[model samples]
Structures are given as C-alpha cells and as structure tokens.
Target: MKTLYDVQQLLKKFNIYVYVGKRIWDIEVMALELDHLHQAQLITQDEFIQAKLVLTQQHRIEEQKNNGRDL
Candidate 1:
C-alpha cells in the first residue's frame, strides 16, 4: 500500500477493522494482517515488503514524536 489509508482499505476488504488508541499498535496490526495476506497468497512478497517498510517508517516517526514529548 502507498499509504496507511490504503492498508486500512485492504483490511476493510477482508472485513478486518481494529483500533486501540496507539498508532504503533495500529501499525503493528497492519503488519500482522499483511503477513497473513502474504502467506495466503493474496498479496505479493513485494507488496508485503513495501507495506512493512511504510509501516516501519511510520512507527519510527510516531516513536520519535512520543520521545520528543517525553523530553
């Protein structure tokens, strides 16, 4: 997916929707869903890798923002 919203839309197509206040948690959930999709052959390895990279970058940014607030 090109964006988090795109990932969310993919999950929606599978009837999966989840949120728990934490942004990282949401990203982690998306990663898990992406893994499942990959294992099921619903998505390509390249898509999985790209989507994980996006989520990883976003997780890092969110973590940095949280750390900044703690300063």
Candidate 2:
C-alpha cells in the first residue's frame, strides 16, 4: 500500500506534477483523459496498458488497506 510518503516519492521518481481536484487527485483525472486519448488513437495501446496496470495495482492496494480488520 502507498503511504502518503510513498506517493510523494513516486511523484518525484516520475517527475509527476498533480493538480488537486474536488474529489480525487488531478493525476487520476488526467489518467482518464489519457485513456480517452488512447481510445481516440492518440496514445499507443502499449502505453495505455502499462498505465492501466500501474493504476490498477495502486487501486487494489489502496482498497485492501482501507478494508483492514480492526485490531
């Protein structure tokens, strides 16, 4: 699971800059935008698959952490 610190490190590692959003990170919204581009043939399938994989993993981990059993 990604802690806030890990997320920060990931941003630095990827040289990513995210703008905050109303209910989600701007980066996430941008991802959907990218997906739309991919659907429109702007980005290659390989790039879209890679991004989808990474985002899926992150989301899965976050979901698991959020469902933790009470101690």
Candidate 3:
C-alpha cells in the first residue's frame, strides 16, 4: 500500500467497495475493514501494516494541506 489507489485495489480484491465522497474517509473505512480482516485472519500482518502506513501518511499529508490553507 503506497497510495490511495493501492488501498482501493486492496479493497477491491476482497470485493469491499466504499465511497463516502471523501478520499480520506474512504481510506479510513478501508483501514477499519482491513482491521476486521486481520482480526478474522483473512489478511496477513504485513498487508495490514502496509495499508495502515499508507492511509496514515496520506491522511496526514491531506490534513497538513488543509491546515496550511488556514494560515
């Protein structure tokens, strides 16, 4: 998981599609779903870790951009 597209593809592989009109929200939901999959032993720890890293970094970058506009 290196980008939103990567996460989207990961979700797609499991037939888990979600769109909340915001990329960040979509990624967040995917993170939750990935967690469930991990808990269920459906996905590996490596996949979970990579997906989470991508989501967190992307979200943080977006947040920083939003904050920058307020200054």
Candidate 4:
C-alpha cells in the first residue's frame, strides 16, 4: 500500500486492529501482525512487502518526530 492507512485497512480485513496509544508502538505491532499473516500465507508476498515498506517508512518518520521532540 502507499500509506499507513492502506496498511491498516489491509490488516483490518483480517480483523486486526492495533492501538498502543503511541504511534510508533502501534506501527511496531502492526508490523508483527503483518509478519504473522504473511507466515500463514493469508496475504500475497507483494502485499506483505508493500505493507512492510509502508510500516517502515511510517516508523522512521515517527522516530524522527520523537527525536525532534526529545531534542
């Protein structure tokens, strides 16, 4: 998917919803859930890869924002 929301929607199809209060934590959990889905062959390899890319980018952005706040 192209955005974090797209990834979330993909997970939602499997009834997976993650909210750990923090954005970074939520993203981390979503990644874990994606891994499980991929392992189970619930999603295609392409979908898995795209979702992961989205999560990684979002995670990096969150990290940068958090780092800026810490500074």
Candidate 5:
C-alpha cells in the first residue's frame, strides 16, 4: 500500500489491530504481524512487500520525529 493507513487496513482484513500507545511501537508490532502473515502464506508476496515498504517509511518518519523531540 502507499500509506501506513493502507498497511493497517491490510492487516485489519485479517483482524489484526496493533496499538502499543506509541506510533513507533505500533509500527514495529505491525511489522512483526506482517511477518507472521507472510510466513503463514496468508498474503501474497507483493502485498507483503508493499506493506513492508509502507511500514519502513512510516517507521523512519516516526524515528526522525522522535529524534527531533529529543534534541
């Protein structure tokens, strides 16, 4: 998908919802859940890859924001 919300919607199709009270943590958990779904062959390779790319981008953005706050 093109955005984090798209990725979340993908996971939601499988009844997976993650919220760790932090954006970064939620993204991390979503990655883990995506991995599990991929390993189980529940999602297509293309889906997995696209979702991962979205998560990675969101994670990077979140990291940068958090880092900025610390400075």
Candidate 6:
C-alpha cells in the first residue's frame, strides 16, 4: 500500500510533474499520458506504477470532496 507521500517521492525521483501548466488538467489525463509512454516503452513499469498511484490518489480526493464527505 503506497501513501500519497510515497507517490510524491516517486514523482520527484522520476522528475514527473503533476500539474506543470495551469490548463486545469486532471489525473486522468496524466494517467493516459503515462500509459501512452508505457506503451511506447519510454518509461519503466515502476514509473507507470508511481504515476498511477499519484493519479488515483488525486481522483479519490477530488471525488471525496465533491461528495461532501469531509470538505
């Protein structure tokens, strides 16, 4: 089980950016790009895993807030 902190560290380790520009993009886009990179063999499985973890965490947090569970 990887925590958000772990995901952050992994991103830093690979020099991956979560939100570089202010186009208001979500994790799904990032996940898709990462998947494309994986398919192209540009990044390793570990990189993909870390990206997936971070993206999934972001999605979950957004959904929770939208549901008004904890604000």
Tell me, by lDDT, which candidate is best: 4
Compared to the true structure, candidate 1 yields what TM-score?
A: 0.84
Candidate 1: regions farther than 4 A off:
none
Q: Which one is best on TM-score?
A: 4
Per-candidate local distance difference test: 0.84, 0.54, 0.84, 0.97, 0.96, 0.64
Q: What is the lDDT of residue 12 in candidate 4?
A: 96
Residue 16 of model 2 has an lDDT of: 52
Off by over 4 Å in 4: none
Clashing pairs in 4: none
Residue pairs that clash (backbone atoms under 3 angstroms), model 3: none
Clash total of candidate 3: 0
Q: What TM-score would every model get versus the actual structure?
A: 0.84, 0.53, 0.86, 0.98, 0.97, 0.60
**Model 2 alpha-carbon miss at residue 36, Å:** 0.7
Query: After superposing candidate 2, which stretches have Cα over 4 Å from the reference?
Result: 1-31, 69-71
lDDT of 1 by residue, 1-71 (tens): 67888778877887889697799888888888888988999977787787788888888999999899999
Please write out the lDDT profile of model 5 over residues 1-71, one tens digit for every residue.
79999998999999999999999999999999999999999999999999999999999999999999999
> Cα RMSD (Å) per model?
1.3, 6.3, 1.3, 0.5, 0.5, 4.5
> What would you estimate as the lDDT of candidate 3?
0.84
